[model samples]
Target: MSESKQDIMRFPPSKITDVAKALSGDLRVRILEALGDTQLSVTQLAEALGVAQPTVSINIQILEQAGLVVTAQGSNREKLCSVSCRSILLELPSRPGDGLHKTEEIRMPIGMYSLCSVQPPCGMANRDGLIIGSTDDPRAFYMPERTDAALLWFSGAGYVEYRFPNPMPPGVSIDELRLRAELCSEAPSFRMDYPSDITVFVNDLPIGTWTSPGDFGDRKGKLTPDRWTSGTEYGVLTEWSVRADGSYVNGARAAATTLERLSLKYNQPIRLRFEIREDADNRRGINLFGSAFGDHPQDIVLSFIRFKEHQEGKES
Candidate 1:
């Protein structure tokens, strides 16, 4: 057991049953162990656990609710997860506090590279639709400037969206909130010349779709090994909000977040999604690109990064 911020908060070992319950699941326990010294995403964690990404997400949810783990939004809206490294304090149940609410600060992976394949009819173009590329060849990939490229695509199964972490220093009131993303497609037209109306979702709520204009890139892109050569033209500057309970593109309050958005507790998990309904887009296809850009020796796409504190909050 550990000491508390005040003499009042103490948690006896008997009360640790909740913590024990939180740690009871084999997968949950493994997550804590695997996170011993690092942070990982649902995709990475799934790969490490040898299971589907959603499986790991479900387990992470359990751990988060139990206060055993915490999560943040990573590049591409993926969940970045890490264990809560806090000391436990045994306090009297009759007192003001019980168990341990103290938590460690969590670090996350930074964005580096991304790619995506949009359906047909979406008109895959560059930053301007003037140079609409051709995606007739499914084996092609775009060679946009490494510094400003992020892949965007549509899926009937839908894509997971991640929200960046906004730290609230001590006691600051957070009223209005914003969610934004830079997106583009692979094919010139989504499908049969249909437009791929992509939408964003945070915590299972709809935000909106590609609304800006044109596509990404300037013209025929540079060639890269193991990538598609013929690309399409179409792109957008997507944005969402919780304000109006609606989705929008570019600079609009597609949706709005009240206290619920800012109510997120430290060392807890959050969920985001990029959803495309079946028969909603042009081609009904998924495209992707594998890339990383930087002079640094690390993976171009940000790997999961984590941080742990030996002491709880500052009062330990």
Candidate 2:
């Protein structure tokens, strides 16, 4: 794929130090995270970060010097700053005694999912926490602007899938693969004891299942808008990993599947499917958390681990 179209950004090892230094400050990192896609004036950034404008300006200068941020004169000659990249990633080989190999991670916004097969009570909201189409309507999922969804939920068994492009070099076999998301059961009412059997599939291969405890509306989600109080709030951040031994959820063995059995192709798209099987012991439904409305500020994430020397690293 062309550099302009690449999903994950890769940098040669020569850039490790500079990038690391630029990202070393917590305030600068927060600034980048808050910038998202739209340009934010320095004052807006300060307000969002709860910091003074001068503090934000100082950090923005550092980011500008490192080429990670760009500034433009806005209305009234005010300076607006924005991150230059959608995401930044770095791969590192595992140190001795660590249980893994080299790893690369990517965060896929919930709305960027490539496909879906959902049922009613299914709807999505944008970053502002406004419903995109209509509540309890399946047609909402088909809207062209669904990519703006910051939170999605449904009431029955089905799946939402994402197709991640494979960027590894030829012959680089993965030792382990992990998918993490903040999710829970979806209910019309906040049912604390409700259980949903949520399953994850990689490239159509079943990895494992996680039983979400409930819809969890006991408290407002850390990032959820104040206006969203009656609906499900936050979800549990869960991780499903397919290792050399077997599939694991939250560090416990959950399935008998193995890494090699996944048959992850080196040059083909990797499809991730999250479903609540029709015959599942518990079909409480599913609620997928997104960066803007979840207690955990992230969408679905995928991590690739290579036990041996990664050819792609050298190529970068």
Candidate 3:
């Protein structure tokens, strides 16, 4: 039994009431615990819990509406239910007098790239697994509907660029910058040994490169839309961070580019680009995943950790 890729789901503070309501029932809690590892049909779940099938079905429907579980038709034609996330996190808005070390977070959809230059075997799909346009057509990359893309893949070398708004206030200096996304190597069908050198750039300057282990398709992605029944399922979540000292991928130092080199300032747009250079040692290609199609329920997240003069002595 494989659990969902992301064990946690985060919600804003405003949704606490709704989330609380979803978990208020004892049956719902038991259903979640039962579905923690393996998906089960309503009848099976009812039998295991010693409850009537109709009673379980009713609760399952409520859980589905609350986004706590997702259901699909099993091979036997029965509805199969699985837990959506293992935990929940509530994000509370910061107060004005909290502190001087303010952090700004932005999430960009995978398809919202301002610029893209992709080769053949490239394509985009929404959460419903519908192709945005013809596959391998560069023109499709410019489609206005791309903003809803949940996954994008390309073979060989190519790049996608995004312009992020700088959220630092005047006179404030950025102490750290972090970018996170779920990605993996791409192959026509799928390969476990395929490797790809995925690189990231800030302000057109190379930040670092991460070597994806392979194009994985061993099993269905926990969050993958039900319509997608084939091809690669999910990707590993990767995080790249940069500070005055150095840059790192998943906390391991990978580059020496400092925050000063990025020159992040107020009113200036930050350019972030992802690419698989033609000259890369491994040109196997790459896949980018969004919240709807990845193990991680997040898009391209960019975080700016800023430090004010008065907060210089404080730890973030």
Candidate 4:
């Protein structure tokens, strides 16, 4: 099955038994194995399973009833059945009615970064569409009023770092650490062909790199101010997660980085950095959009799930 980040089917504790029952039958499991990640019509499934069409259809109905499969009409009007999702995550709450098993999250504003070592073409602007300080000056990032900045940009090999306050309870361990931001490559104005390798560091450890496809500006951004008619308009919402096994960017394995190397064992602040090295193959620069300047109405966000020993044992 596809392990795409957004391709998970999460079920509540109440529905776990129902889904389990759907997979109890050997014929249904075989049907799913035949389908894999592809969709197949009843006739096609029957042929693949070497079973009668009527039998295949009956099993398909049972799987659909348990929300294990989805049926849709094909181009030729033939019925198509597919395993609903690439993977399934069942949240077994420590106690009943835990409400989707909430996780700790922090929506850090873009301008709240603690430090920045940047170069020319660096600048910041407020929500009113006014520059915070002089453009192409790294000193502008240190201005006191930068907290109100709605947009920021910088070029060359440097980074903007944030020291997030650690609020984890003593003795608790984290299962995953995630960060999401709306960003894109920077150019003179905006270029559709520019690309840049942006790397993310957590606890001062290199975790992953997401190569921005390009500086997106074909059309005006939905949240961009009307007066700001030129230059880069928007960015893509990218997510990076560090897990026990390795690091992942938008569901794809990005690197061999894992939580153990992050030095997150202690309850200390997390220093996160987005850096573009001087030797990068694509050094187009970086553009970070705030809540008021990007297509997405958000800045930088950090989130994670903590696993207590008892809860972990119960879940396992």
lDDT of each: 0.44, 0.82, 0.85, 0.83
Cα lDDT of model 4 by residue, 222-303, tens digit:
9988778558889999999999999999999998889878877445789999999888888878999999997999888888
lDDT of 1 by residue, 31-83 (tens): 87787657788888888878888778888998887666778999799899876
lDDT of 1: 0.44
Ten-residue region with minimum lDDT total, candidate 4: 93-102
**Pairs in clash, predicted candidate 4:** none
Q: What is the alpha-carbon lDDT of model 3 when measured against the actual structure?
A: 0.85
Q: What is the C-alpha RMSD of each candidate to the true structure, in Å?
A: 15.6, 11.2, 10.7, 12.9
**Model 2, 1-316: lDDT tens per residue?**
1232234456445345556778999999999889867689998999999999998988899888766788999878999887767666665533221222267677898988788888987788887778888888888888888888888998779989999876455556677788889999999867888999999988787888999988899888999988776578899999999988999999999888898887777668888999999999999889998888879988888998766654443445
The TM-score obtained by model 2 is: 0.70
Expressed as tens digits, the lDDT of each residue in 195-301 for candidate 3 is 99999999988888999999988888888988885588899999899998989999999998999888876788899999999899999888999999969899999
Candidate 1 has a TM-score of 0.36
- List the candidate 4 regions with Cα displacement exceeding 4 Å: 1-101, 306-316
Candidate 2 residue pairs in clash (backbone atoms < 3 Å): none
Best of the candidates, lDDT: 3
Best by TM-score: 2
| RMSD of candidate 4 to true structure, Å | 12.9
